[model samples]
Target: MIRILLADDQRLVRAGIRGILDDEDDLHVVAEAADGRAAVAACRELRPTWC
Candidate 1:
């Protein structure tokens, strides 16, 4: 699986991205962040393959 970290201030934007990526069997959204800081934190915590 391709782990991913999604960051966006808008909830809809994040959701939309998640939805789109979720359709792919080889891709996964491991974490979602509302800001750059949270995104960094999530990346550190999840350690995604493509952060």
Candidate 2:
């Protein structure tokens, strides 16, 4: 599986992207952040394959 961290200031945008990516068999969303700082923090904690 490929882990992912999605970061965006817009909630709808994040939701939309998550929805699309979630349909894939090999993709997984492990974390979400509303800003760069939070994204960085999530990256450090989750260590997603794609961030």
For all candidates in order, the CA lDDT equals 0.95, 0.97
Q: Over the stretch 1-51, how does candidate 1's per-residue lDDT look in tens digits?
A: 899999999999999999999999999999999999999999999999888
Best of the candidates, lDDT: 2
After the best TM-score superposition of candidate 2, give how far the Cα of residue 31 lies from its true spot, in angstroms. 0.6
Please, what are the lDDT tens digits per residue for candidate 2 over residues 1-51?
999999999999999999999999999999999999999999999999987
Q: How many backbone clashes does candidate 2 have?
A: 0
TM-score of 2: 0.97
Error of 1 at 18 (Å): 0.5
Q: Name the lDDT value of residue 43 in candidate 2.
A: 98
TM-score of each: 0.94, 0.97
* Lowest summed lDDT window (length 10), candidate 2: 42-51
Per-candidate RMSD, Å: 0.6, 0.5
Give the 10-residue window scoring lowest on summed lDDT in candidate 1. 42-51
